[model samples]
Target: MNKPIGDLHCHPSFKPCNNPDISDIWTYKKNIHPKDLFKGILGVSPRRWMVNLFVKDLATYTQSNLDSCYEGDNRLLFLSIYPIERQFLRPDRPFASSTFVQRFILAQVFGIELKRHIDSRIIQILTGFSSTKVVDYLKSVYDSEYVDYFKTDFSLEYKYINQSHLSCSPNAEDNVATFQLVSNYEEYAALRNQNIIAGILTVEGAHALGEYNSKDLVGDKMIDDLSEENKEKLKASFIRNISALKDKEQFEFTPFFITFAHHFNNLLTGHAKSFGEAKNKSMPGFSNVFNQKNGLDLGISDFGKQLIKSHLLSRHNGQRILIDTKHMSLQARNDYAAIVKALRDEGDAMPIVISHTAINGISTRAKAAERLDTNQLDKKSYVSRWDINITDEDIREVFDSNGIIGVCMHDGRMPGGKFKDLLKSYKKRWPQKEFISKLHTQMFLTNVFHIVKVNLDHIRTLNAQIPIEENRIPEVQAWKTICLGSDNDGIVDPFDNFNTASTLKDFKTRVKNAIDMNFDPLWKRFKILDIKEENYRFFNENEITELKLGLTSEEIVDRIFSDNIETFLSTYFVRAYLEGTEN
Candidate 1:
């Protein structure tokens, strides 16, 4: 009777079965398999209904007909061997085999070697563009008819860029490199497929050292860091890049979730505070803290603050934006809390999302690996949020601020079976009626609604509890909206399940069965048999009505089935259904 009724976090790798007949789904678990990870391009039978179901990439998205969507696994399932850097994203240039000579020729097409002049004028590098050289590189990629699709994902993910990196300059070594290229030459090479109607261009990190005051370069006068002419030249270079994307090719340059370093602090800090922080940047090139020589004031806490300032520059552009917090720090998370308040103060409703991350502090250990799909025959090392390094107070800070956090699938300290956890955590934290009554006169200045509470933690400490007539924030208001925020392909083989990727059969069997079970008998002496589906309606319909998210219980059901995830995502990512339409 005490079992929870809803699931907030689950990966769609499996099917969620709500049918009330098969209560003990362990019998059906045998049907799910690990190889299902290759469900898309490999062996997954293409079911027609699978059309509207693929997880839309949170990055760049153009008008897409689900029919055209090659619903490949989100993870890098396989990579081509012949290509130097081939993660066969699409059946593009990398997928095609080329002779070493051809690869050499393609690489040698653009031989522009760059260097830094003693002039502190770094912005001039943008004007260093060449029509012939740029055009030649573009031809090398598309000239071969072997490509299935030439995909161009441009983001100067500099972590992979190092001394062997041809795009960067050797002369710029002595002085700090003003900027780093996100995408290497190959990605840009495949961009202008004049025949290919749509390509994608993205602005990576904001680490580029532009003159602080951009507007001052308007005239043919001298500016502060670079000459006014150099500033103008740099501005022109960026304009050319944008022009090429929008005008020359019908590429949709919808940029979202762009950041210099995903977890910037972990990268900036030379010393690792934790094993997780050690591998902050995927590419390990030149790195040092911003100190006096870097012409910046330094502080212990400023690293977190600086990351926010850099992101806010793009966020404040007045072009309705979705701020990304994937690599942001807890200090920065706290800072963003203030930023959101100030934004709401100004009446801005632009939504934001932390696209990828497990519930903080959940993966208790560094290497807690669980096979994505299991029939519950093996030991389950479930991770609790308290186990993750991040504190409970930090989670409260985020939720209290009205931010939505997604449950990631990859293994970590965070626990699975989110449907039950969602209700358990809410009931645990709710304030009691007596405490609310005593504080109501002072807290809300009125004896309005009573509070009902249960403590999940420190169970023995909470005793002699009595039921209250009403609940906190009025019976009309409780945290009603819990949405699925799954990371399908970040890690594990073929990805799956509630806390992981799951096949349709696995979802219905394991995740649904766990949620439907009556855990009230779990504490008893005899073996606690899981109740059959006919025994309970699963969710308490009355409490469901009392819950609030400005939507009815029927609507909540719709959300639990589908809508909420869309609404939470619509706040940040563009929906596949509306890719062609304007935001």
Candidate 2:
């Protein structure tokens, strides 16, 4: 592996959603006299990862100071927008049965990124809809009679909209200097090169659709039970009330928003050993007459199945596509497997691969999560969390599907955790058939110290085991996938041992010093910093510069870096979604 390896996941251009902190920071960057080039680049990069720097907790901006320093570079950024698709039977989600209500509530409750709790209330009302509580209240005043007509609530909608204007500024003035942001968004595809990847947008969830023929079913008594603590009760209430609102001629339930945590977690509950049968189709799935038993059945929602089916026809059309099944749940994977077989049966070739993984047969340490101690130090206690990794069965599926799985760096996705624990987590996620605890926010932020530690440990683990180069994680001595996925501009930690944009020289110097000594510079090796310094690469410019294996070889390298992604997009990505592909 002689090349200057790069990564597919890097967000260099992002912006803050309406917090006031940027004004000051921008001012500092602009005005800081005796400007140093190094400081300038470093200063801007952090602002990208941690938006907290751009806004005050109180939501005010320190603008005066920022205007002075940030006078130099104003790079237009390509930002991501979350389309709120999480509500759509998203795969690998633990709490599926409650996702619709939960995600909806969560979107409103914590989606302060786009609007405040109060503002969301207005959008609901003005749009002929309202929050769970308000909708319930309205149901009482208005019988189910006018429910289908959004116009029925025109008076209230107008009143709320008026109130919103009044609250922001005088009714006559639209010049308030307020900045705000949100979740559940749909970013324009054309904005990619602009340096943005607006987060996900919401696609129609199955639950959001009900029988289309019914009319006038959403109303009052339905409102009465809106606040019930019990989930099943709430679900039943929604189905009954919303179902009843329609005219008998038009009423049919549309399964929009989604629901299907329908299966039990046998692995966690001790009903099964590690995910032994974690195959696509072989795992949990819904059996309908349309599915032939032996075909690869990926457990997708009816909507997902359609999407995957369409995706396959449009993109794969017999071309190879690496389907990273990492984020998919057991059932979803199975569903896809079925679909794959069906495609093959029809003489359609579908080449797919699981991008990264490990073996499952290995026992991993418990505290293998990437975590941190109170002192911000890395510790090796494998708590119940961060121990989950891909399993052996997971690998077998990918392999059987003729897929490639990348063994990743960053300690099996559990940073700052012990090496052994990380290994165990990886094994589970890969060739094994069991699942592990997910990495939550606390573990993510707290695990910085362990990242640094694990990299060190990895170096020690294979000091005498493998060849000079492969020993650097990503090899048999150390298999690693692209670890740049969530370095998040080095703002968030657990990559405690990473190189800052500023001290890159020092980091590389240390690695070089150790190269000939037969010791490991583990974490350092995983990172790619300052592309100018090509020597750090196993096969840097010197090795690759003139070695013409012919145009095809160069073409292959080109394909490996950006071309593969392009090919992937050509095979599957909607050109409509190609807006920001370059970045």
Candidate 3:
């Protein structure tokens, strides 16, 4: 096993599984063999299959299961507690037509593989039925009136996290590798010293605040269109949920951050297009069904702004939870950025956060959109140009705010140079060993490389305004902003080579090896920007030379894997902003 590393965002319990103990994470073997399949089909229906001919959004095997995390040496993780948005379940248009169609969409949305079946208890609970049959569950979904289970789901997750903590026996005879939630740096440090993994709670979307209602009415209703009484009720629910989160007596800890927007509009703020075109290409029938682009043009709602100001970003029990800009629409991001700036101007220590994202390599939101309009996938660039990703302007903002960015490991979002085409080619050459590995690893490295470049460029621009005699920003400072936001078990198609949290140990090694093999060629290629590529290059010869001088390959890799996150937490995850008061 390799040394433990940190992950900015992952979900260890989003999948449907049966763990009776509740304190222990369920572990399963890959039993997708023909014999197992035959037995499963005859005895019980399998939820997972070798391939889903109908739906492309197949379930990935457990990526960050506690067993995998313990094995992969992922010691510190910020678990994204997402209450699966209702829009995803409801879908739209064609998907709502037939029962089989509903089942197929449900399988895809829930990430259930054919060889595996969702735990009967879970299915029953989701559908509100006593029968453990899939048909019954579907019937319940279609027949039952709308009911928002967001709060129920959120509370259940808390139970899982808390019980999982209680289950950890780090000092037992087996010395079982396990984790505990750490609210403060001191607790994290203590856990580290004991060789126990640390988990930090983070909410994935503001929608998790509460959205109780029928799937039909609440999934797509804009706040403005809702009746005044309904709007007030929703607001009350949101506030009640927010207050519950602040009740330390119940939750025992505060979430470090809450992402304001996600796949669908929460009526609080709009969201960027989450289900990209590339992903839509996989599920031919469900093209653009999940993204809900109608709300993409909407900015932060008046109510959303108030909640962020009065509840989320405001101090609660002396701990102010930050906001993560991972899935916010450009307009919402802009609005939030201005709010952050204003807060900072008033002497607040708010740090900008973009958890689980890729770099688009474009300078600004408008330019990225222009590039996307012509080149839908932005394959010409070294990284994906999807607007869901962070732009050069976003990177600059992160740097200026002394904030942090978690580079996601999702392949769909980290595309480089006709990445889907490459994947197709790689699939054709399947039996060939290391071919796919080399391809995906390169894609991941490009994202990391571009992030470093963006940070370096930001510093270079700042240095240009100063005297030559003044100390230039050390190039190594560029590495500090990045941490691994793998989005493991978050329904992401991770790098094939680094598929699971267990593989991240190998990922660290691969990163070092990839850097050693490809650094020079990549550096040169990036310097000469093609017409197709955005104007992302901002460093000169002297700056490059200084970067080489300041950090060794080993040092840079180490920072990405663990040290950078530790450093970020040391400064930001403290008792207060006052110096020497981190404890």
| Candidate topping TM-score | 3
For all candidates in order, the CA lDDT equals: 0.25, 0.26, 0.66
Model 2 CA lDDT for position 316: 27
What is the C-alpha RMSD, rounded to one decimal, of candidate 2?
A: 18.3
- The lDDT, on a scale of 0 to 1, for candidate 2 is 0.26
TM-score of each: 0.37, 0.33, 0.82
lDDT of 3 by residue, 37-118 (tens): 2343432334333223322332335677776787778889898887766555444543443356444544553443431233
Better of 1 and 3 by TM-score: 3
What's model 3's overall lDDT?
Answer: 0.66
Instruction: After the best TM-score superposition of candidate 2, give how far the Cα of residue 438 lies from its true spot, in angstroms.
Output: 25
Task: Output the better candidate (2/3) by TM-score.
Answer: 3
Model 1: per-residue lDDT, tens digit, 110-200?
1112111100011111111123322332333334322111122122211111211222222323322111111222332342322111111
User: Which one wins by lDDT: 1 or 2?
Assistant: 2
Q: Candidates sorted by TM-score, descending order? A: 3, 1, 2
lDDT for each residue of candidate 2 in 2-112, tens digit (9 for 90 to 100): 222222221121111111222211222111111221133333333222222111111021211112111211111111111111111112222233335443433332233
TM-score (C-alpha, index-matched) for candidate 1: 0.37
